[model samples]
Target: MGQNTNIRGIVQAAVAMTTVGTLTAVSATVSRYPVYGGQAVRYAVAAVILLGVARLRGPRPGPSARWEWPLLAALAATGLAGFNVCIVEGTRYTSPATIGTVVGSVPVVLAVAAPLMEGRRPAARIVAAAAVVTAGAALANGLGGGSLPGLLLALGALAGEVCFSLLALPLLPRLGAVRVSAYSAAAAVPMLLAAGLAVDGTSVLRVPTRGEVAGLGYLSLVVTAGAFIVWYDALGRIGADRAGLFAGLIPVSAVATTMVLGLRSPGMAELGGALLVGLGVIVGLRRSAERPLAVAAPADHHDPAHDEEGHQDQAHDDQHPEDRRFVAEKAADHGV
Candidate 1:
């Protein structure tokens, strides 16, 4: 069962990488539209897609009580709006590849925050591996060159991602990954729109070009809505930290896509960076073995079948209120 849980975690990580691909595409495509107008278009489309998904997930009368609501809002807000701001604002200082390399630092951020999020003492191996990954990210993105600002932005984004996921943990059990993600995406829409209005004024409301429309469609349907659902569902089954390790693949896939389409060519530095990222991933997976997970976070509320037979070091006993609460919390925790 533990092995299966790990495998599911790997699956979730892979799905997460795929989701990030869609996001990266959306980011590049949005560039085709005028600055402010493009952002408004992106959010308007994302909002509609999330609204549809919210309908399918069904709504609860109130917010998820699994955690304090305000904290959860901050977490969701970071992912939804903060990530965007970081990327957009961060880009002003750096190139996209530099962003990728910096974004790759997420594993390190996860490793750092893991203690707080899951109550686990990170092993030495994890620390070493995280260092390697960060180094790889720096090299991959040309940190020594004019890419310094971009690298900083990328690191900031990585940090934001770490905060978003860790802070989001408590909310998962009750809000469900679907509702939580949808609400986050939905909330970002207005803030994004406001930012767009501030920058582009009435221009943001104008009709988009054909390329812009295509980009919008791709982002709304496939990237934001579809991939978000898949990624979070996997999160429910597995756990966030495990799910994050797969992010190493995003830069690889992104670079490959561009190369294949003749949009860009790979240079020696980029190739070396890929090698470092690969090594970092290998080290990360290895580190997971050296240390026993200190604190078992919990399970997903969406699937009771995932509950371990002897969960929370307690036998299942309906008569005991404490035991029942343990099981309930375990079940809702979404394998955190």
Candidate 2:
């Protein structure tokens, strides 16, 4: 089971890297459509596909009380809307390489933030792996010139990603990944549409070329639909911190894609970075594999050590209900 989980995590990482890597290739099609409008379409189509799949393969959508709607809306705003807009707009003022370097640090942020927010020290290996990944991403992108506005916008994208992972981790237990992803995408449609109107207005309504339409379909079906489902599935299976580390593979994959397309060959530095990313992933998996599995006992079965741990965890949750809830849910999901 542990081996299978690790393999699945690797697969998820590969999927995410491919999804982001394809973005560069699709830029020509993306340019043909209004940024916000194109994103709105991509997300809307993905939402419909996910919703349809959910209706067929899963239970009804109701998970909790009405209060969750606000959280869902927030996910839509930040994860779906803000992430896309920030990256798109940021590139206008800065190079894509700069944006890649900035956004690649998200895994490192999650590695640090996960432990602190949960009131525990992060494992040394996880931190080390994150650092290696971050270094690899920087090497892949290089320390190039970038404007202040572009840097800030790149940070916004990073922030949006942090919110997406941190916020969605807890909610996965309640709503499950498919439902949460669908709801978030559905909710973001209006926001994207509104932004599109405010920015490009009727230009968004213009007919797109065949290549552009195909690109939108790829974004909707493959990147958003396939990528998100696999991403959250990995999150649920392996936990968010480990899943986040997989993001370091983005630059590596992007470089590989570039090479495949004969756009440009990777120099020694890029090759070295790719090796580092692969090494980082291996280190991350080692950390994950080192974690002892939790075997849950029946409620009636009383073991002093387990009971004490449970009480301590409960007390921790009581002290900080919001942040600790994610830890609790993640534990429960793992049957810890």
Question: Highest TM-score among the candidates is held by which one?
Answer: 2
Deviation from native of the Cα of residue 23 in model 2, angstroms: 1.7
What's the lDDT for candidate 1?
A: 0.61
Q: Model 2 clash tally?
A: 0
- Give me the runs in candidate 2 sitting further than 4 Å from their true place: 61-65, 287-290, 293-336
Q: Which digits, one per residue and each the tens of the lDDT, describe model 1 over residues 1-336?
A: 255555555566676675565455455655656565565455557667776666775545346455455665676457766676677877778776667666777767676666546544455666566667666655655664335666666666877777767766766655566566666665666666677677677665667777768877877766666666666655554455545555666766566666766777967876886787678767666524333221232233334444444564533321245435545687789774
Worst-scoring 10-residue span by lDDT in model 1: 292-301
lDDT of each model, Cα atoms only? Answer: 0.61, 0.75
Clashes of 1: 4
| Model 2 per-residue lDDT tens digits across residues 1-336 | 255665765687568766876777666666867888888888899999998987876454464666677888888898889988898889889998888889889879988886566456676787788888888877887645589999999999989888887777656655666788888899999998888888898776567788888989998998888887777777655556667777887777777877887888888888888778778867876733334211111121233235555676654533434436657787999999
